[model samples]
Target chain A: MSDFLMFSLVPMTVAIVICMSCALLGNFLVLRRQSLIGDAISHVALPGIVASFLLTGTLASSAMMLGAGVSALFTVAMIELIRRLGRVENSAAMGVVFTSLFALGVLMLEWNEVGTVHLDVEHALYGNLESLIWFEGTSLAALVDPRALSDLPPQLARVAWMGALVVAFVVAFRRSLVLASFDADFAASVGARPTLVGLLLVVMVAVAAIAAFEAVGAIIVIAMFICPAAAARLMTDRLASQVALSQLIAVASAVLGYVLAGYGPGWMGLGVSLSAAGMIATLSGGFLLLACLFGPHRHRREALST
Target chain B: MEAWWRALIFDAGYNTSLVTLGAMLLGGGAGMIGSFVLLRKRSLVSDAISHATLPGLALAFILMALVFGDGRWMPGLLVGAGLSAAVGLWAVQAISHRTRLGEDAAIGAVLSTFFGLGVVLLTVIQSMAVSGQAGLTGYLVGSTAGMLAAEAQLIALCSLLLAAGIFVMRRDFLMVCFDPVFASTNGVRVQRVDMLLMLLLLAVVVIGLRITGLILIVALTIIPPVTGRFWTDRPLRVVALAALLGALAGYLGVTLSSVREGLPTGPLVVLACFVLFLVSFLLSPRRGILATLMAHQRFKRRVHLRQGLLAMARDEAIFDDLTMRVLRRQGFIRRDGVATPSGWAAARDAEHEERLWALYRQYYPEESAQLDHRGLLPIERVLSPDTIMVLENRLMMGRGAHP
Candidate 1:
């Protein structure tokens, strides 16, 4: 148990917090019909982090976040520009911008000899979750030690603040967000500034993406940003309850996924642990599948109401 | 640099020639197919389909390793890739069509989850007794540096077939993309054609997986069609031009990467397509950014000139700087803002047209909806000679009442 606590607990907590923040943002993204923006942002964040590493010559988290934030914003602008200028559909424009930028990031990483560093493509995709061990917490009692608690993984603290920030943003602007999402012109008529709220939501998603990226990787960030919230979206019509249920779903998937990835194969005589991020994503997908199959409000709005 | 020039025309070497030929064909095929995909508003479906190829590739690799001790056969892996991509497409359709989720949400979910599951299976592969499991991850970002002759041949053959497939189905694609209900009404089998389009796209993707990898293959599919859209308005022309541009990108990207030894072929290909896209976006004749800006400038100039002439006819000062510039540039006014001879003449014309327009609108109230949109053009440009004659006579007759 102490071994489990020392080896797996902090990483699991980071994963859960990351999921919570991502799921919170996903609720609004799904409702606002920009769910794939998370995927685009996560893909483009690769170049931003790579560019930051190239410029600063360091692995500082704050600088990397700035880089990822700039790229995410850039991705949004480029997608919009392409959609407007190229006369392409929203998803097609998104596909063009994110894939082109991701290719550039990969090229940048390869052009330089950054392959030997900790910032390879694999690390960018799968993250450094497994290696983020809490060295200060040696035994179970160290969990109670204030020094050990203080010295817990920095990602845990980062993801916690990110969760709080996302929660606060959503709570503070809940009415505007809900109103704008349901009807942009109606909300605009009532002084909601739907465009500004949408921009802010993208910003919050970028922040959450950068926060979760290093711990759970880009795949899980995309999965968490979409699956739990989407599943919860089918669960209820009310926004508050949907948000609450998504967080529940997020936390559940993260914990169960972590446990399963760590111990499931061992119990089945496979004798090797699986990837925690991949497992979390798979579990979230499973939850969404179930929700699609059995959720009461799984039909379209007109179908449900009329 | 001389070697670069040689490589550009396929005179570099045997291996270089093979890869370049394969890449050019693949790029053309993707660009052609992507044009239809873009027209259908399902360009991102390629992203979902490509990502879903991972588990299929991994599964094929493991199965082939178990059976043949070498899981790197190009045909088997591509077959596996094509199958999984079709499955992913079905899942996306089922989710969006059956459940309440939007297509974008469905795309995101299927891609990430399928990719994640593939990653789990990859870990399983790593634990197996395979000899050369180290190279499987290349399907993600693609590494063209180690492609074999047989793989290149397979890619070339598939690209040819996909191009043919898209060509044969172009009419059906047009109908289905433009008006699905109408197509179905015409017995076009919209669902089956849509699936065939995706099937052709996934085959191209499976072929491209060896060249650009799953992540960047989407770039080839998206950027080329977007670039093509800028060049022309006709969908057929867009398809042809996009294919040409895709071929050019492939040729240039491969040759340029050959010249510059350190860069990977996939990014070079993508970057090449991007460069083409950028140039087309800003410089293409039909819908280029420069053309649009110039069109806007002309419109602005016309508006300023019209308003300034009206203000001059009303005996008001043309205080707006743009209006003054327009008047001065067109020799309608002097530098000191005094009306020149032509300026007076233009002002008289403007006053007469304003009156004539009022007479027409007042007399032909029913036709005012069409006449209300009259911009900078003179009444001669819009109305027939007979109508203008009648309108001019009415303007002359109503002059005393207006005064």
Candidate 2:
């Protein structure tokens, strides 16, 4: 039990927080027809972190976060510039920018031998989720002890704040965000700044991605950013309820996925642990698949246009 | 430096030359097929397709290790990658069609989930303690440090087939990508052609995996096609230019990576593609940035010069600095802001043209609306000589009526 407490508890909670923040902002992205921006940002995050490490010569959380944030904004600008100036499609523009930047990141990673510093392509993909153990918090009582709480993995606190920030942003701009997402032209005519809302939403997504990236890796970050919200989208047409359901789905996926990854193999006599981050992503994808098949609103059958 | 030069010209040994040549061919094929993918608005689908190959790769590794005692068979893995990528494309199609989610959403879902499954399987393989798994990671970023003759030949032959297939079906691809509805009406099997094109694209993705890696291959295909767009508007020219650019990038990038000790092949190849894209983006005569800016400047001068001439004809005080400078530069006005002899002649023509326009507008409102703006273009350019004469008579009558 102490082993579980020392190892799994903090990582699992951190995973839940990461999922919450990602799912919260995903509501806006999925509705606005920009789900792939999450993929692009996460892809570019590898480069951003590498560039930051190269510049700052440290892997401090703040530095990495700032680097990722700057790169995310850069990617947005690059995609916009290419699309507008080159007259390319939006998706194609995104593909070009993210892949080029990602290649730059990979080249930098290989050239500089960041391997000793715990930076590699595999780490960027799956992350160090399994090793984010809370050594000081060995027992259940340690959860309440101030010293142990203080010693908890710093990622937990960062992800928690990001979760709050995302929830607050969603609650504050619920109406206009929905208006802009559902019908940008109508929203613009009605005196709302759809572009401004869209920009703010993208910033929130970048922040959430950075917050989750260190814990769950880019793949899970993308899965969290899309799967829960997409599954919830199939369940309900109401945007608010959809957001609520996605949060629930995200939390459930995190807890269940963490448990299954840690203990499922033991129960099956394999006697080896699996990756929590990958398991979480896989479970969330399963949730989405299930929703796609059976969710009440999956077909949108009530629409007369059909 | 001599070694670098030798590598540049592909004077490297037989094995190195084989790899370099294979990479160049693969690049050409990717660009050829990628041009069609871009025209069809399915460029991002390549990213999803590449990422989704992971699960199949891991599964193939497991199967091979279990049966053959070696999981490093390139053919087995490429086949596996192709199958999974096809499944990924199908999933994207189904999700977008069956659910309310857009294609972008489907791409995100399929890629992340499939990669997740691959990662999970990879961890399982790690726990199994498989040997010779180091090369498996090479598929991610690609390495040319150790070249095999068979692998190079396989890549070369596959690329040749891919390019030939594209060459044979070029018209069908162009017709389908440009206008599926039109092609279908003209008796083309739109769906079949689209499927065949996708199969060709899958081959490009699978074969390019060793040279450009799966992740960077998206840029390999997409950047060249976009670069090709900068050069020309003709569809066939765009296709040809893209293939040439891709081949150059691939050939140059592989050679350069071979010159260095630590440099990886995939990223260098992508960077080469990006350089080509950047150069064409800034330098092309028609769609490039410099040309667009030059055209805008030329149009601005015409507007300013025309407006200045009209103001001089009407004796209106011209306060716009651009108009003043334009008029002064063209000798339409003196340094002291008075009209010169040639300036007066030009102003008289302009004044007469303005009157002609006013009469033309009053007589033919519909046609006047269709003309480019109002005053910049001369009346003779748009109307026939008979129409100009009629307009000139109307101008004289209007002046007489007013005077």
The per-candidate count of clashes, in order, stands at 0, 0
Best by DockQ: 2
* DockQ values of all predictions: 0.73, 0.75
Identify the candidate with maximal lDDT: 2
Q: Tens digit of lDDT per residue, candidate 2, span B95-176?
A: 8889998888888998888888888878877877668687778778888777578999999999988888898899989999
Model 2 interface DockQ: 0.75
Q: Alpha-carbon error at B275 in model 1, in Å? A: 0.9
TM-score of chain A of each: 0.95, 0.96
Candidate 2 residue-wise lDDT, A125-155, digit = tens: 8887888788887888997899988888888
State the C-alpha lDDT per candidate.
Answer: 0.86, 0.87
Model 2 alpha-carbon drift over 4 Å, by segment:
A300-306
Candidate 1 residue B63 C-alpha distance from true site, Å: 2.0
